[model samples]
Target chain A: MAAMTHTETDGKQGLLPAIPAGLRAAAPVTILLVLGFLAPLLTVAAYAFATPRSFDVFRSFTLANFSAIFDPSNTVWMSFAWSLAYASATVVLLAAIAYPIAYGLNRMFGKWSGLVGVLFVFPLFVSENVRLYGWVLFFIKNGVLDGGLKWLGFSGGPEVLYTPGIILFGMIYVYLPFMLFPMSLGIAMIPRDLVDAARDLGASRFMIWREVELPLAMPGILIGMLLTFVLGAGAIAEAKILGGQSVIPIAQDIEVAFTYAQNWPLGSALALLLVAIVSGLALYVLSKLDLDRILGKR
Target chain B: MMKISRRNMMQMMGAAAFAGPLASATRAFAAREKELNILCWEGYNSAEVLDPFRSSQGARVKAESLTNDPTMINRLRAGETRIWDLINVNNPWARKVMAPAGLIKPLPRAEFEPYFDTMLPEFKAPYRWAMSDDGKDLLGMAQRFGPYSFVVNTDKISKATAEEQGWDLFNDASLAGKYGVQESDDWNVFNIFLVAGINPFKEHTEEEFKAFAETAEKIFKGAKMVGDMASLNQALVSGEIDLYMTGGTYSVSPARADGYPNLRAITPLKGPIDGKGGISWIEITSTVNNPELSPLAIEFLKYVQDPEVSHTVAFAEGTFNPVSQMGDPKCFELFTKEELEAIQWDTLEEDMARSAEYDILPDYDKALELMTAAKRLRG
Candidate 1:
């Protein structure tokens, strides 16, 4: 009877195709992605198509939200433009600022690099809002900088708070670490031997850097840019806390629609558009890269 | 050790999973009887306010605070009515939205009406906002209320000039870049309308909207800064801005409490809204129409009406404001001289009298869009 049971089990196992080991390993993460990420996105998409200002998600469908957003009279698009512009600015400025710092950490810091890295990361322990408020206190009239200047027998510090320039400054300040760490990793990945070999071949420092270092570091640099850009695009706190809502970012507009306006469909539509733009850019950039090589799998 | 087959193990796991939810359901059902859930604005949810009620009732009391009235009301509209036993929001929502939609239960008139007797004269029995539109049902209890308008550093812009100039302060081209605007959307919209010489509550013509759009643009353009209360107060203290629109007692009280008494909230002496130049907000705490409403909800309603609780609610969350019960000597005496000064108790009566009740704007969405556009344009 045991032999017969074993024979039946073998028959059943043979009839059912074997699952791929990779698929079996991926099951948990795939399920998590479906439940956690895809479900909320699908809900947002469904709501994006619902009636304007109505919570008839999944039950109704309309393009009124899209129409309103696209309408020339509607200036909501300016918010999106401002967000992308700020994000672009943040990426550019952070790239310039972080590249030098990242280089110094990798090339100049020696064994103290880890401690220096920790120093760079320390500010993140405090809430971004608190730190920005600290900046507010520093720059505010009769605040630290201004008061110090006054004590030193000078006019108070410049009115730097609540300007468009300060919004960009705050984004650059808040997202500096995001740009720095990835960039440091990228710079570290550049083999010292390759640089030495190029020097031995009489390659000038600039030539070696431009030809070898930049290309090799592209992956990490791109990752940092993407990270900072995405973060900056979605930034609301810097604008609120530091920029003083001088610029209404798209996120705040979306928030207002959902909160004060109680128009979920409109908010969802705005959110979906932002997600599409960001994810589209991300996908395009990701598609051009060899992630396995970047991740050291090769 | 006992050996179990793989099949038996799977069966046992499945049974546990099925039983887990059933046990949780049983526990949740049991908890409902001993739980009182409240949804309110910030002050009512403060530990200082809720801890006493929790101990007195010997029940689990939880409260959530949302800054926006429409957002909180929308939670009920989204079926959170089943979750909350009490909902406190600005006055109009109870009469204009919640009671009409049956999201909130009307209070027992005989039991709740007398609480108003001790309240401020403005909130006297048959208080319009606390009652249903038909004036038959008492929908909620009035509590924290104050005139909300622009605030100024009295040292930079004297209170007398500010009150007299009123909303025209924002319109003055010479004062451009000298003042700031707070990021309170509804209040900004109202102030923008007032600056444009249009009544915000009434329906408007396209021409009026055009004027509103222009005024919003000008205001955003002229502002030295735009921020929340704290930032505005800081700016005011530092002289970064002489004054800011969309501020009042609720926004300036903390600064006043901190000894920067020069940061004063000014209600304009006269302008639109039936010649009342300021907008005042009165919070109405009502019973939510939950399927299994806790009896403790009514007890809490009565408890907060007590002078001591009323005083606590007024000063809760670090932002000082006046309560309707201050008309009662017991409640009035609870406030110290400093506290009274912080809340600008001296001007409270006159300001309220000169202020129009904050109301639902007929064209708020359009105004919000225009305002948002103007802010972006400034950026």
Candidate 2:
């Protein structure tokens, strides 16, 4: 009952708590974000416009970058579409798998929520690469997954991580906690009377869940989902370590340009395109749910 | 009192900071036992010249295989000690970036002198760019050379006159859309210039770059896919691609071993683009800048070049035979005449003799720009 009240106790005080820093708070991070991610991007954008031999790097402007990006004969766009599809698949599958785990934690472990959360949180301690390597072992031909399935008479050899399925599993493993924590918090905070009221009114289990539990859990669900989607869309490491050339992602392609490919302006252009994609998503999520307001100080 | 004030003023102006800080960080490189580690590629683990030291010397060797450049650089940059005793790297990374980062140490002459002849001149060039101005400071050594050339799966192309027929394999009408080219190397982009018979260095205009791009656009017409050396090799073996462009067709022995009896190499008379082939500067550096391990590291360097070790690795790993053949006639018995040619960097040097040179490996900024552009183009 106390926790239920806590959920509705003003949308402020989560991430956007106000007291001292005010405008200067975001100033530091905003400046950092702009300088760190955007500054390089802006430089790249400038170069993308410059011709190969142009003297004035900043003022150079042309559409060759755009033309190069859109050369239909090339495989660039096809790869973008492929990554988008893969990321999308990752999100849908992750959400479905995570919701149950979130529910189990919220309902069964209210007495030990903090401890259980910590236990669930242990995977974060190791490096992302180590975790990806773990997935690699699990996915190899005679790895744990195949061996386990074979014992059960499933008879599958080439398992998930070696193929497209491995890439998806990596995405899910990384983002599952992103979904679970928030959804669990929301489920835990849902008013007990709501469930009881639906039962008393002779509502079916599906109806009670759909009309009652879901709409109220929407805030946590939306926040979790938005985060997971953004992470899925932005991931590069998981794909590179586990997917190889079999599953090329946009993030990996952007990385290869600066490192092995050594083309900065084009790397920048791809980066901007990625920003446009993620930002468009952020805006949509912001409009649909009063997330910032809910998250902001009351 | 007046003189004292003058002296004090002089001291203030000539403060200790005026004495330049250590040229780098104050950390010491002391000899420590069994504490450091190494990261490298699969070919880098050859046993003949290098691997014997691991057991006989009573030292622990933890070598990891990684081909991609970014991951290796990132791992080194992440500030972990006890990571590696050696990190073998390629140009222009060894010179342009990693050395500046102080992640590696300077190579000593004592360690380098014995194995010096085994290293070719191209092998010695990176040391200048990487270790010192003349590259004679001995900061690193070259283990293998991969020059740019083309390989054809004879099962696919079936050319009876390959050595004479040349690069028409790229534009052959029947092979259109059915062939493969490396998506790496901006130099390969200039291969289009070669097929069109243009010298890229003759005050090459944008027309040349575009002509190459257009040629590329045409060759790519109806193409099923594009990828790197690994992909091209896979395609050749799996019958997916008919022709492969690589650092060199030196893999002819192994390709032949794969039972493609008709496999052959065709380095064009006009030369393919600029030479992308050169040396890698993967020298082992110690955090302990000591007399013991330093000489031992050098000894290991010399010991590995002993023809026996080079022969063992060249056969096992399909990387080149790094030993100087004239120096060791006995090593000749280990490989066939054709196999010996397959491991020789001199063979490819003949092909690269007429071509212009572009340092595809440059400083970080240029490195990023070229690869980024290629990725953008590949995309």
Candidate 3:
């Protein structure tokens, strides 16, 4: 059989047939995937080192883009510090609330949890503009909640959109679904006997949860919270339209460079730097937590 | 009094039918062998404008409005060759972004002809004009101009004096969070120069820079940062900001026409910041594939030059400016030619004479850094 296959391969001369068979069929799809996914990013990564030399000759091996972003004028240090804090807060709040809802529905309702799932996921179908606008209208002085508060005798028009508290509210609102989905899926993996086993041993509810539920559910909580945290970290439209410039996000820096400033090299550098830093943090977190084992598969 | 006449109204509805057909009947239009795909905004070539051009030239134009020039430039940079025959480009975006990206057709002066003469020395802005330097026929014709000035909500602003200007909206006792100005370097650089009382056309002293910085500090201290017309308009209409500065009327006209009752505008007594005379510059340029179709496009381009359609676009669609000197001063089919001229072209020279030139394009990167620094400093 091996000799027969070798004779056939020798006849073919190491090339696939011209028609859509074997290598010919897969060649186009592989080329397309590589071109679509890798080429643009490679071009941008190349720009991270782009610098003018003599007569339009560019020497593109420097780390200058990364250094420039960290320059004092970029104010990236302060902005990113604040962004991390904001994201962390959003993750905590979203996870704290989303866990109960996701876990309860998954446990109590079984297949009917799908209806709750639809309700949770439905807002994703709406445009970001619609979501932001709804929030903007909700937080203004004469807005729905404000009017209700006024009717209930809240006297002040307290610049709700401009406040940090309101920003926290918005970040949570946008990322809760991210938090909920991952968390619910995580909780589903836990065996029912673990909780029942804890309870039957005469442990109180708090003791059972602290020992059994929290540890098992941790991976989901971590992954879910991480997704929310990352999304919140780079959040732009929410802070831009609704945050009222009282607090400008670092993403706005990217906007100014790309759009109004038209300085793409700088923008690309800044953005790529952000990617590097964020990815570094993510890897750090994942390694520390051993997410591969937690997820059980890659 | 509705400002739309019957015959023109019928033509408009007819044009709408043309639009719906064009989207579905792409292959049939391809058979016309005369279809031009233009990437532009809603105001640049509304059906009212393109339909007449199509009927006359047998060349149909399909315009797709983009978010901004830089975004369009990126699309073009990605080798968007056959997608667009004409596009709207910003002054600096065309210079720093588009032209540098090698996304152009290298148009020369000989082809532009009479419209070539129409570009004044100043109107021949930085980057697009560079295309002409390559010794080839030019690609695009400028459609409308953008004028940057202060606009006041009539309900809030009672004065229009020069002293009332000087970035004092940041200091106005009644308006603190209620007034807005743009956050970009274009606005920041000009506002600083103006508040420092330096003329951009002339040199600046060390004292001027300090004064500029000081007043900028003052203005930004209490001022709200505005991103664009959408943000400014929302605030302006919702009574968030009663007065705003450093904006173009290209996006402001219809918002005013909406008859907020509180809506009003002023050129400001001293003139626009640094007298750079920012205006919404709507122009058209043909891509390489459509170079042969210039006759048809130029014909359509000439139609756009007509004060009639220009006025309708500016006054109704919020893309201000389609100006011509020879047209009847009061006889636009849409806006009286007088109204059209007012919105389209006058602010450039008037601002140049009254205020310092606003040089926001150069040192743009530095300006961004400064603006962010200023924002941080404010915090």
Query: Which lDDT tens digits does candidate 3 get at residues A172-211?
Result: 8878889998788778867789899888989999997788
Best TM-score among the predictions, by candidate number? 1
Summarize candidate 2's per-residue lDDT along A196-278 as a digit string, tens digits: 99999999999988998887777788778878878888786665556533455777667665555545456666777777888
Clashing pairs in 1: none
lDDT (tens digit, per residue) of candidate 2 on B1-379: 4556775676766675565444222322433353225566556565543456767776555556666444565556644324555665544445555666666566666656555444545444333543543455555555543444567766655544443455555666877646655554444544555565554334455565556555655554523344545445544664545676543543454555454545555454544444322212233332322233333444455554666665665565644433332244565466666665554434555544533433332233332333233433432
lDDT of 1 at A248: 86
List of chain A TM-scores, every candidate:
0.93, 0.78, 0.82
DockQ for all candidate structures vs. native: 0.76, 0.12, 0.18
Model 1 C-alpha lDDT per residue in residues A1-298, reported as the tens digit of each score = 6579799978876776586658867999999988997899899999999999888888998999999999998888888999999999999999999999999999998999889999989999999999999999998888999999999999878888887788899999999999999888888899999999999999998999899898888889999999998898899998888787778899999998898777899999999999999989989988988798689887
What TM-score fits each model?
Answer: 0.95, 0.55, 0.77
RMSD of each: 2.8, 12.4, 11.1
lDDT minimum window of 10 residues, candidate 3 chain B:
B351-360
Instruction: State the displacement of the C-alpha of residue B135, model 2, in Å, after optimal TM-score superposition.
Output: 11
Residue A294, candidate 2: alpha-carbon lDDT: 45
Q: Model 3 misses residue A29 by how many Å?
A: 2.2
Name model 1 segments beyond 4 Å from true: A1-16, A20-33, B1-17
